[model samples]
Target: SLGLEKMPFFTDSTMAKVMLLLINTWLGAPYFMVLISGALTNIDGAMYEAAEIDGASRWQQFKEITLPILLLQTSPVLILTFAFNFNNFSAVYLLTGGGPINSEYRYAGSTDILITWVYKLTKEQSQYNIASVISIILFIFIASISSWNFIKSKSFKEDSE
Candidate 1:
């Protein structure tokens, strides 16, 4: 082993939250970057030209042409990512194990999101009934979000004429 000591990332409450945030961001950012860049490239150059001909300013062009297209193109992935990260067990579990315990919350740590807290309830605390109820509620909530996203998403709407 190298002489350099390993920093205790999980020892402090705020630091653990920061570390978890950093980890999740670092792990997930590149995929979104690649997808967004791909979406950017797919935008037609003629749209900007048309907007320019219509006397629209660059900001107007972006607002009118770019933002809507990008939002439509990436809305599905964005929604899915939100749902996935809502219960991202691995990111918090593998990195900090939901550590830096807080005295305020019983059976939960500072970085413990709801999913990890449920996990702790079931696995560590042996409180199966509460964990089951929580899991059911979480499933219903996530399902509702996903259903709403699909229903309201312009990208997913089928045109029937």
Candidate 2:
């Protein structure tokens, strides 16, 4: 009845990915916003006042005071969000059903990310070993990225200090 399936938004190979991206962004933006807003609240009002007294413009205040602090506070969360979203299965599976199948790739759809591909590989094709390998590789890849980001983030350094 929703007619989502028949819609070109979900049926075209390219458009389906745009729909998936929009859906994923719509789902995730709130959580990131909450964290970021919390970080903004935590920033010392004294800092802004000090900047204002020194004749720093709002743009200058943001560039010097707000942006760096927010980046420091939220970098870890951002990295982890990336890792989580990188493996997001429900976003693709529920929205697209991994449909608008790609003619080029075997057993894969245009909107299908690694995790959804694993689901299809294991559940439908019974390609257990291939799925397992992909899962392990994905784990390693995401872990490495998150670990690197955390190691480089000011939060991690400050926490260690």
Clashes of each: 0, 0
Model 1: CA > 4 A from native: 1-8, 159-161
Given candidate 2, what's the lDDT at residue 68?
97
- TM-score for each of the candidates: 0.90, 0.88
Question: Once model 2 is optimally superposed onto the true structure by TM-score, how far is the C-alpha of residue 97 displaced, in angstroms?
Answer: 1.2
Candidate 2, residues 1-161, lDDT tens digits: the string is 87665669666888888888788888878988899889999999999999999999999999999999999988877888889888888888988889878889777888899999999999999999999999999999999988888888878664543
lDDT of each: 0.90, 0.88
Q: List runs of model 2 lying over 4 Å from the truth.
A: 1-6, 159-161
Q: Assess the local accuracy of residue 71 in candidate 2 as a C-alpha lDDT between 0 and 100.
A: 95
Query: Candidate 2 at 134: error in angstroms?
Result: 1.4
What TM value does model 1 have? 0.90
Give the top-scoring candidate (TM-score). Answer: 1
